[model samples]
Each structure stands twice: as structure tokens, then as C-alpha cells.
Target: MYYFFLDDKMLPVPPPKMEVKVNNKNKTVNLINEGEINIIKSPGLTEVSFEVMMPNEFYPFALYDNGVSNFITRLSGQQPTITYAKNYIDGFEKLKTGNNPFRLIIARFNQKFEYLSDTNMLVTLEEYNVGESSEYGFDWQVPMRFKQYRPYATKELEITTNENGEQVARVKQTRPTTKEVPKAYKVAANMTLWEACRRASGGSLDWKAVAELNGIRDNNVLKGTVLNLK
Candidate 1:
């Protein structure tokens, strides 16, 4: 048999290669389609993510040609990069103040819905009646663009140095005094325990707790007993 120059079968086969061209001006990534669409939307998902580029190790032909020919370069790293600038969001600075309001805008095609809340947390619920065709579905998978007022919670605080000369941080929890109590010595005459408790503690101190604390029973007040106001 004629001898071959070298065992060609012993040589390693070349692997496929790919190149990427990123357009920073448009914030778009272009890559060869391997049956994977870059755009994704899911109703059952809470978070969304996608790979803009693969690692150099995963590239089979990356080492070929001494790792220089047909090499991939990140667009951001390229000189004279093409980058686009977008306007800052409106009311972002104003939202930092407590006066800013919350807005929830949802759009499905042309349909739109918006909700406003003064608080940071929001609760939404939907229900379907058992007899009404039993059709109910929820999709929390969509990405939400939230514009929050800066400083969700704030209070005017006064701080003083401790004995060790260390600064101390204090938080105050204050809500509107919704309920009013009877002023000192304003306990209604011939009132029941419930009535007295209602008046004495601004209707805030639990009636049961008040009764237990002051030895009152039910709605009945002790007759002819002087109330000791502390």
C-alpha cells in the first residue's frame, strides 16, 4: 500500500466558531440563532434575565489562530464606542420628597390601568365564584417599573450624646391620635367600666386591659369611689 505523509486521522478536527457585534448606540446584541430567541416573556415568572454574551471558555474555536484572528470584542470596550443617552426619569427627584405619590400603570396592548397608593406596600387580590364558569388566572411574571418617592418613611428626630459620648439613633413611631380619652378628672359620673375605660385612655387602652389594671368589671363602675388619676 502507498504510505501517507502523515496520519491525518490523528489530527484534531476544527470546531465551529461564532462572532458577536454589539451596537451600544441601540443597546442591542446580535448573535447567531441557535434556536433560542433573545426576547422572552413569561406569566409564571417573577424575575427575567438573559445572557448578552457567553464566556470565552465556552467558545470552542476561541483558542484557534493563536486567539487573535476572528476574535470577539465587547462593543463597550471598542474605541469610539456608539452609545446612546436617555433622559433622566421625570419626577424622580421630586419623588424623594414625602409629597410624591405612587403610581401603578399597567398596559396590555392599548388597554391601560393605573392605581395610586400613598404607602410603599401594595396588596392586590382577585377571586372567581365557583358557579361562574370557574375562570380565574393571575400573572405576576411581568416586569414592574416602580418609581418610588424617596424616603418611604421619615420622622423628625432629636438625638443627644450618651454618657460615653457616643451618638445615638432614635426612631419615632407616631400616628394620628384617632381616639380621645377623658381628661384628668373627666371620668364620667356614674359611668360603667367600659364607659370609664373609653373616656380615661382616649379609647385606645384596651378596655379589658384597663379593667384589669384598674380593677373594674364589665361596664359597671364602682359607685362613690374617687378615681386616682396618675
Candidate 2:
């Protein structure tokens, strides 16, 4: 038996059948002489397709009163739902906008109904399908699809600094900064004050200082204007 939960609340009706697909994308180069060359392989997206069944007995009171069609409307609406499973180990929060990514855990069940191997995935809901429905005592079928969502992790670097004349390794979040100070630079086409400072200083200069130095009231900088970088 498969169990589904939305956040802490388990879905009243669990779909009878659920399909999970893992996709991998690879880059190939084709030449006239050579047949093909594999350049790189990308961590592809994972998709979960399932049909939701809404029965009058299992549906919420609101849905049952308003009609089973409301169930499809709710799923198709902008609201997000965090889904997980009881027997299956994997779960994820469905989001409507932005980087709607979440960790997913899938657990295997044996003949005795005990969960065995577990697989974790990071994914997002890509799209969904609302198929034909039957109104025989209020029964509906809704299909959904989920894709993979991956975000780059930030890395920290430790630097040895002299604190109180003692060398110590300090760890800090690294951001782009300028190092070398330039005397002046002509504002190029499509150049912003922020970009100018970044180019003048290796990576340690701030854009605010540049703006203050140039007396720039607005962010827009005219092209071919030479500004002092001191």
C-alpha cells in the first residue's frame, strides 16, 4: 500500500498507481569522419507521474459538498503542497514559483509490507495533466508530473591571517571583490558603476565607494565618461 502526505497531513486518497522516472542528459559532438563524441553528461531531471483518484468517501467535506471537480481546481491552483509518504521513505514540498526545489525520499516495500531500500532525490513539480473525468457517484482522476531541481552549493575558503601578530586560519564566506586599485577608467558601453569598480579593483572594491567618488546620483553611467577610481 502506498501512502501520501501533504506536509503533516496524509492525503486522504492515495493514487492506485504512481510512476517515477529518472532522466539523464548527455552532450554529444558529431563530426564528418567520426560518428559521435560524448562531451559531457548532465545530471538530468527526475519526473514523477501519478493519477489522483477522488472518491466521495475519502475526499474532504468541502470537496464532497462543492463537488469532486473542486479537487482538480485545488491541485491546479497556485497553492503549493508538501508531499511525503508513510511506507515510502521519500517526500518533497511542492512549490508554485521560484526555485521550487525539495528533497525527495523513496522507500521500497517488501512482500511483508516492510520498507527496505531508500532513495533520496532533489526535484520540483514541472507540470500536471487533468484528464477526462467520470461523475459516477463523484470520481475524478488527476495526473501530475515532477522534474528535478538542483541548486549550486556555496563553498568557503580558509585563509591564514595575522591576528594580534599570530597566524590564524580564518574561514569566511567568499564574495567577488576587487584587489588592485586603478587610477581611472572610461565608462564603456553598457557599463555600470558596479562593474567599473569590479574591473578597477581586483575584487575588493565596493560599488558604493565608486558612486560616492564619482558623485553619481543615479545608477546609470553614460558611456565614454572617464571617472576617477581613487
Best prediction by lDDT = 2
Pairs with backbone N, CA or C atoms under 3 Å apart (clashes), candidate 1: 95-150, 96-150, 180-202, 181-202, 182-199, 193-219
Once fitted onto the true fold, the runs of candidate 1 whose alpha carbons sit more than 4 angstroms away are 1-186, 222-230
Per-residue C-alpha lDDT of model 1 across residues 133-162, encoded as one tens digit per residue: 112121011111222222345676768789
Q: What is the C-alpha lDDT of each candidate?
A: 0.29, 0.51
Count of steric clashes across candidates, in order: 6, 13
In model 1, what lDDT does residue 89 have? 14
Candidate 1, residue 29: lDDT: 45
Error of 2 at 18 (Å): 3.0
